[model samples]
Target: MMFKSQRFFKSLQLLIVASLLILPLLISEEGLNSIISTKAVFKYSIFCFIFLSIHFLHRYLLFPKLYARRKTILYFTSLLFILAALIFTRPFDRLMFELRPKPNQVDAPRREPPHSTENRPPMGNERRSGPKIDVLSVFLFLIIITIEVIIETNKQLSLTTQRAISAEAQKTEAELSFLKAQVNPHFLFNTLNNIYTLAIIKDENTAPSIMKLSNIMRYITDEAGNEFVSLRNEVDCIEDFIALHKLRLGKKTTLNYEVKGFLDAEKKIAPLILMAFVENVFKYGISNHSSNKLIIKLAIEDNILNLLCQNSIYPDKKDTERSGIGLTNTKKRLDYIYPNKHILEINDDDKLFTVKLTIHL
Candidate 1:
C-alpha cells in the first residue's frame, strides 16, 4: 500500500514537472498549435526525458552509492561529467532540425537585403545556440540535488533515532529483569530462614508458616515477573509476607502494620516494590531480649500512593553487607519504573530507621 501511494505521488510530480516545462510553448503566439507541432513536440520531449533521466540517476544511484558512502571525489566527478554531457548535448535539437527533410524550401539559395549588424534582429537559430550551458537549467539541476540531499539526510536521521530508541528500550528491559531476579532469590532466602528457625524449635506455627510462604511464593511465581500487578494483589502479597513474619516474631517485638485508605481494584503497582522495606523491618528491627517497635503504614488518596515504614534499630543486629542490596535494587527499580513520578526518602538515625515513599499513580 505504501509503495503504491509513493509511486502515485512520484507519477503526479513528473506530470506536474512536464507540464511546467511545456507551459512556455503552450502560451506562445501559436499557443497549443505550436506545442502540438512535430518539431516542437519532439524537442520538448527530448528535453524532459534527459532532465528526468538525470534527476532519477542522481537521486537513486549517485547519492546512495557514491555520495552517501563518502566517495567524495568520484561523486563530484560524476556530477561534472553530467554537466559536461548536458553542455555538449545542448545543440541536439538544432542537429535534428538540420538533418530532417524540409520539402517546403527550395534547394537554390535566395538573395536577401542585408541590414546593419547593430540594428537587425538576431536570427532564431542564433538565439537558440547562444550558450552551450543554460544558466537557468544549471540552477534548476542544483535545486533538484539540494532538495534530494535534504530529504535523504532527514530520512537517515529519523532512521538513526528510531534505532537508538529501540536499543535504549531493550537495555531498560534487561536491567529490570536482572533486578527482579535478584529480588526474588533474596526474598525467598529470608523467608525460608524464618521457616527453618520455626521448624528447629518445633513451633506449632511451622506448618501454617509454610502455608503462608506457599501463598507468597504463589504470588511471586505468578506476578513477580510482570511489569505491573494490581494494587489488591500486591497488598495481599504484603499481608501474607507480614503474616509469615508474625509466626516467628519474638514476644518483646511489637509490629504495627496498617493500611489507611481504600485500595482501588484498577490501580496497579510495580510488583514487590514495597517488600524490601517490609522485609528489613523483620530482619533487623526485632529482638527477643529487648522491646522493639516496628511500624508500617500505606495510604492511597487522589491517585497517589504513600508508604511509611519506621523501625527501631538494633546496633548489634546490623548486617551492613547484605542489608543494602535489597534496598539498592528496589531504589533502582523505582527510578527505572517511576523516575520523577515517585519520591523516596530514607532516614537512619542512632535508634530509628525510617523510610517514606510517595508515588503518583
Candidate 2:
C-alpha cells in the first residue's frame, strides 16, 4: 500500500512538471516572439501534451505488459527523439519565423535576393530561421521518464512480495492447526480399540467406561481448541481413561487407583491428553500379566495433577519398545503443548514399570 501511494504521487508529480514546463512556453511574449504566435504555440503545446499523455497512458494503464520490459523503454525514448527532431524541421518553423517584420530595404521593390556564396544571413530572417532541437532538454526528459518507469516497477514488485509473505504465513498457521487436530482423532482411535477389547471379554464395566469415553470426546469436540480449560476437567478425562483401561482388563487384573483433594471435573487439557500412561501400562503390563496386579494413583494439590501408576513387567521377558506411537506421540504433544508446565517420569525394574506425571494446571 505504501508503494502504491508513492507510485501515485510520482505519477502526478511528473504530470505537473510537464504541464508547468510547457505552459509558459506557449503563453509568454518571448517564447511567442521566438517562434510562432501565441495562438499557434498554445495549439502546439496542447497537441504535444495530449499526444504524450495518450502514449504514456496507453502503455502504463491499458497495456502495462507492453511497457514493463526494458526494450519498451529504449523503443519509446528513441521514437520521442525522432518526433522532436521532426518538429524542428517541419514547415511550421518557416511560418512562425515569418511573423517578424519585413526588412527596411524591402520598400525598394523587395528585389529577389541573390543566394549568398558564403555563410551569410538570409534576405529577411535571422541566423536561426526555424525551430531549434535542444539535445540537452530531450536527453533530460528521457532520463526522467526512465526513472519514473523504474520506480513504478519497484512499487509493483513490492506489492507482489507483500502478498506472497502474507499467504505463506496463513498457510503455516493452517498446517499447525491441522496437526493439533490430528491428536484428538488419535485418542478416539485408541478408545475404540479399548471398547472392542471390552466387548470381547464381556466385561460388566463396559457401559460406564463407554459413557466416560463419550464425555471425554465431547470435551475434545467442543472445547479443547480454546485457550484454557479448568484443571478439574483434565482430571476427569484422566479418570475416564483409567476406567476404560480397567474395563478391558476385567477380573483378570487387580488395579489400585486413588485421587485426593476436590478435583473439579471442569478442568481442560489438550483433549484426550492423559491416555499416555494408561496405554503404556496396558501394552507392557497387563498384556503380559504374570500376576495381573497394577497400582494407579492420582491426586490434586495446589492446582496440580500428580499421577502415579505401576504394574508387572511383560511376561515374555520382552523389553517394551519405547518407540511405539502411543508413548512417542504423547511425549511430543507434551513437550509441544505443555512444555515447562508438565513433568513426566518413567522407572522400570526387573519386576515392574512405573510412571509418574505431574501437571501444573
Candidate 3:
C-alpha cells in the first residue's frame, strides 16, 4: 500500500510539472488562435510532442548511458546529433503549414524603397526580417533535463551511504554472536577443570568452588549476551573466577590480584572481555614442582580502563597449544567492539608473558 501511494504521488508530480510547462504555451495569443484552426492545431500538437519526447530522452536515456558513464565523446556526439536533427527538420515541418490564402488577380508590380544603395546596408550585412529560429524552448528543455540528472545523482549517493551503514551493522552483529558462542563453552570448560582437580584431591573447598561456578555461570548466561555490561559486574565475575582457580593452587603459587581506582557503575565494557587473559594464567602458569607467579591488575583513571596481566611460565610445564578461545577470539572481539577506542600490547620473554590493554570509556 505504501509503495503504491508513493508511486501515485510521483506520477502526480510529473503530471503537474508537465502541465506547468505546456499550459503557458497553450494560453498564449498565438496558441489560442492555433487551437481554433485545424491546420495550426495539428502543427502545434506535433511541436509539443517533439519537445516532450526530446526532454525525456535526454533525461532518462542519454544522460545515464553516456554522461553518467563518463563516455564524454559519445555524450556530446549524441547531443549534437539530436539537436542538429531537430534544427534541420524544423524547416521542412514549417513548410507543410505554410498554406496562406492567395490574393485576387488585379495586383500591380511591386516597387523597391527609394533609398540609395549607399544608404541601405550591403546585402551581406543586411539582417533577414523573417522570424528567427526559436531556441528558447530548446534551452529550457535542456535545463530541466540537466536538473533531473543532478537529482538522480544525489539520490544514488544517499542510497550508497545507507547501504554501507547497514552492512557494517550486520557485520558487527555476526561478530558478537560468534564471540558469545565461544565465551560460553570456553568459560564453562575452564571452570569445570578447576572443580575437577578439587574433587580429585578431596579438598574441603570443593563445595565452595561449585557455588562460585554457579554464580559465574548465571552472570555469563545473563550478561554475556548483551553488547555492553557494567564494569562493576565484569569485575565481580573476574573475582569469582579467580577465587575458584585459587582452590587448586599450591603454596608455591604467588597469585596477586588487585583492582585500583574508581569503578563507576555507569562505565560499561564488552562482557567477559577481561576474563580471557586471567583464564590463560591459570591454564599455563601452574607447575607441579616449580614456583609460579601471576599478577592481574585493573585500574580506572580519568575514564580510561587500564589492564595489566603478567605470569611466569615454567619451561617444562608450558603447554604447546594454549587451547580454548584464549587470545585469538579476544583480539577479534576487541577489534569489533572497541575498534579505535582500545589499545592492546603483548610482550613475551623466556620466563614471563605480559599483556597490557587500555580502553577509553
Candidate 4:
C-alpha cells in the first residue's frame, strides 16, 4: 500500500512538470499548431523519456549506492558529469525555438530618414530569439538532486527511530521477566517452610496444606507468567494463601480478611501483584506470646481497585532489611506494568504496620 501511494505521487509530480514545460506554447494560436506537428510531438516524447530515465537512475541507483554509502565526492562528481552532458546535448533548444510564434510583418515598410545615417537597432524579425535550454536543463537537474537528497535523509531518520523503539521494548520485557523470576522462588520458599512446620507437628491439616500448595503452584505455573490475569482468579489465589496461613496461626493471633464489591471476570490485574503484601503480614505480624491482629480488605468501585492490609507489629517477628525481597520486586513490577496508574503507600509505626494500594483498572 505504501509503495503504491509513493508511485502515484511520483507520477503526479512528473505530470505537473510536463504541463509546466509545455504551458507557454499553449498560449498562442500558432504555438498551439506547432505542438500538434509530428516533429514537435517526437521532440517532446524524447525529452520526457530522457527526463524520466535520469530521475529513476538517481533515485534507485546513484543515490542509494553512492550518496547513502557516504561516498559524497563521487556522488557529486557523477551529478556534475551528467549536468555537463545534458547542457552540451541541448536537446530542447530547437524544439522551443520552433514552437515560438514569428512576429507579424508590417503592411508598409518603415521609411528611414533620407539624410540620417545614425545607427538604429535591428528589427524584431532580424533578431535571434530562443530559449536558454542549457540554463533550464541545469536548473532542472539541481531541483531533482535536491528533492532526492531530502527524501532519502527523511527515510533514514524514520528507520532509525523505529529501531530505537524496538530495542527499548525488548529491554523492558527482559527486565520484567527477571523480576518475576526473583519473586516466584521467594514465594515458593516461604510456602514450603509453612508445610514443613505442619509436618513436624504431625497436624491433621498437613496433607490438606500440601494439597493447597499444589493448587497454588499450579496457578502460578499456568497463569503467573502472563502479563495480566482475571481478577477473579487472583482473588481466589489470595483466599487460598490466607487459608494455608490460618493453619499455622497462633491462638492469640487474629486475622480478618474481607472482600467488598462485585468481582468481574472481565476485570484483570497483574499477576502476583497483591501477594507480596499478604505474605509479609504472615511473616512479620504473627506471635504466640503477644496478642497480634491482621486486617486485610479489598474493595472495588467503578474501575478502581483498592487493597488495605494493616497488622499489629510483633518486635520478635519483625522483618529485617534482607527479608523485603518480595515487596521490593513487587514495587518494581508495579512501576513496570502500571506506571502512574497505581498508588502504593506503606506506613510503619512502633505498634503497627499498614499498606494501602489503589489501582485504576
Candidate 5:
C-alpha cells in the first residue's frame, strides 16, 4: 500500500509536469496559426524542435558531465561553441524554411514590365540571404536554458530530500536494532540460567534445553540482524521459544499454540518483530499452578499476518521491570519499517493480557 501510493504520486507529478509543458505548445500553435500562415507555423514548430533538442542534450548530458562537475571553463566554452554553431547554421535554417530566393533569379532578367498588373520577382537586395542571424532563435535558446536550469534544480532538490529521508530511516532502524540487541542478551541469560538450574539438579531435560537454546541463539544471531526475514522462520522461532518455556515450567503451565491457514515461506516480515509479545506471555503468564494458561495463534490469510496472543495474568506475579521496554522498541521498529502497512492492538485488563497484530505483507 505504501509503495503503491508513492508510485501513484510520482506518476501524477509527471503527468502534471507534462501537461504544463504541452500547454504552451498548444497555445502557440493556435495563436500562431491565427496570426500567421500554416507554413509559418510549421517553421515555428521546427524552431521549437531545434530548441528542444538543445535543451534535452544540455539538461541530460552536458550539464551532468561538465557544469554539475564544476568544470565551469569547459561548460562555458561548450555552450559558447553551441551558440556559435547555431549562429553559423542560419543559412541552413533559412534553406530548410525555404526562405532563400533562387541564386539564378538574383541575376536574371525581369519577369514582367514594372507597370504591368502581373506580379514581378523580388530584386536581389529585396531578399535577405545567407547566414542571417535570427534574434528570436537566440531569445528562445536563452528561455529554454533558463527553464531547464530551473527544472534541474527542482529535480536535484527532490533527490536530496529523498536521500535525507532514507538516511533518517536507516538511523532509526539502527537505534531500534540497538534496543533489540539489549533484549537479546537479557533473554539469553535467563534461558541459560534455567538450563544451568536443570543441569545442577541433574534433570534429563537439561541437554535438550541446551540444544534448544543453541538453535534459538542461531536464529537470533542470523535473522535478528536483518530488517526482514521469512515469516516461516519467525513462526519456527516462536515455537522454539514456547517449547523452551514448556521445558522450564513443565505441567504447571498450559500453552495452546495453533496455526491456521496456509503459511507461505515466500512472505517476509521484520525479524524479532513479534517475539517480544510471545516472550512476555511466558515471562508473566507462567505460574506453578494448573490454572495458568497462554494462548498463541498465528494465521495467514490473503497475504496478511494475523498474530493473537492471550495470557492469564495474576496481580502479584507481574514483572513490571521489562514489561514496556520490549513493547516500546517493537512499536518504534514497526513505525520505522512498516509505516502504514501494519496494525497493532494491545489489551490489558486485571486478569489477562492480549495482543493482536495484523501485518500486510
Candidate 6:
C-alpha cells in the first residue's frame, strides 16, 4: 500500500509538470481571465522537456547505424507534421490572441485587408502571395527551443550522475559489512575454546578469562555492528584476544609479542580484520615444544601494520596443504575489504612455519 501510494504521488508529479509544460501553448490571457485571474508566471516549460528528451533519445537510441536510417525517416515525417501543425494552428492561435472581451470596431493588417484588385491593373494583374512563414517569430521560437534543450539536458545528466554515485556507495558499504560479518565466527570459536580449556583446568584465573571473553564478545557485537569504529577499539580487541590466549598457553610455552607505534584516534579499521594470522598461531603453534619455539611480532608504524607469526612445524605430522575454511574466508575477506591495502604471505618448512600480514590503513 505504501509503495502504491508513493507511485501514485510520482505519477501525479509527472502529470503536473507535463501540464505546466504545454499550458503556455494552450490558454490565453482572455481565456485565462475567464478561468482564473492572477499574476501566475506560466513560462514555456513543457516544450523545453519535450525538446531535450527527443535529442537524448536520438543520441542513444537513434544515432546508432541500425536505427539511424529509420530515425532519419521518422524525423522527416515529424518535421512535416510540425510544419502542417504550424500552418494549421497559427491562424487559430492568432485569432484567439486577437480576440478581446469587449468588441472592437476595426481590424489591423491581421484582420485581412481588402484584396485590392481596384488599385492597380484590376483585372489584368495576378495576385502575389508571400511565403507561408513569419521569419522573425520562427527564428525566435527555434532559438528558445535550442537554448532550453541544452540547459535541461545538462540538468538531467548531473542528476543521473549523482544518483549513480550514491547507489555505488551504498553497494560498497553493504558488501564491506558482509565481508566483516564472515570473519566474526572464527574469533568466537577460538574464545569459546579458551573458556572450555579454563573450565577443564579449573583455574583460579577463570574469572579474568571470563572478563576477557566478555570484552571480546562485546567488541564484536557492539563495534562490528557499526559502519565504522575507532582504531583504538580494534587494537584493544586484539590485545584482549592475545591476553586470553596467553592465559591458556601458560608460562611454560615461550611467547614473544611486540606492540609498535600508537594508532591515531582519527584512524579507523574493519573489525575481525587480523583474526586469521592470530588464529593460525594457536591452531599450529600449540605443539612446537622447543625452548625457543614460539615467536609472533606485530608492529604498527607510519600507518602500516606489519605482523609476523612463526611456529615450529613437524615435517611428518603437519599438513603442508594447511587449507581450511577459516583461513580461506580470511583471504577472501581481505581481498574484498582491503584490496590494495594489505599483503599476506605464509611460508612453512620442516623446522619453522611463518605467516606475515602487512596492511596500510
Model 3 off-target regions past 4 Å? 1-207, 314-319
- Model 3, residue 74: distance off in Å is 32
Q: List the residue pairs that clash in candidate 2.
A: 229-268, 230-267, 230-268, 231-267, 232-264, 232-267, 233-266, 233-267, 234-267
lDDT of 1 at 67: 89
Stretches > 4 Å off in candidate 2: 1-210, 265-268, 315-325
TM-score result, candidate 4: 0.49
lDDT of 6 by residue, 149-183 (tens): 45445544555677668756765665555545544
* lDDT, model 4, position 174: 51
User: Which portions of model 6 show Cα errors greater than 4 Å?
Assistant: 1-204, 225-228, 250-252, 288-292, 315-317, 320-325
For residue 68, give model 6's deviation from the true position in Å: 26
- Give the local distance difference test score of model 4: 0.75
> How big is the positional error of residue 117 in model 1, measured in Å on the Cα after superposition?
17
Each prediction's TM-score versus the true structure = 0.50, 0.41, 0.51, 0.49, 0.51, 0.44
List lDDT for all candidates, in order. 0.73, 0.61, 0.71, 0.75, 0.70, 0.59
- Candidate 5 achieves a global lDDT of 0.70
Ranking by TM-score, best first? 3, 5, 1, 4, 6, 2
Mind giving the per-residue lDDT tens digits that candidate 5 earns over 160-179? 78877886887677566555
lDDT of 2 at 73: 72
**Which ten contiguous residues of candidate 6 have the minimum total lDDT?**
37-46
lDDT of 1 at 141: 63
Considering summed lDDT, which 10 consecutive residues are worst modelled in model 5? 91-100
Using TM-score as the yardstick, the better of models 1 and 2 is 1
In candidate 5 the C-alpha lDDT for residue 324 amounts to 26
Error of 3 at 346 (Å): 0.8
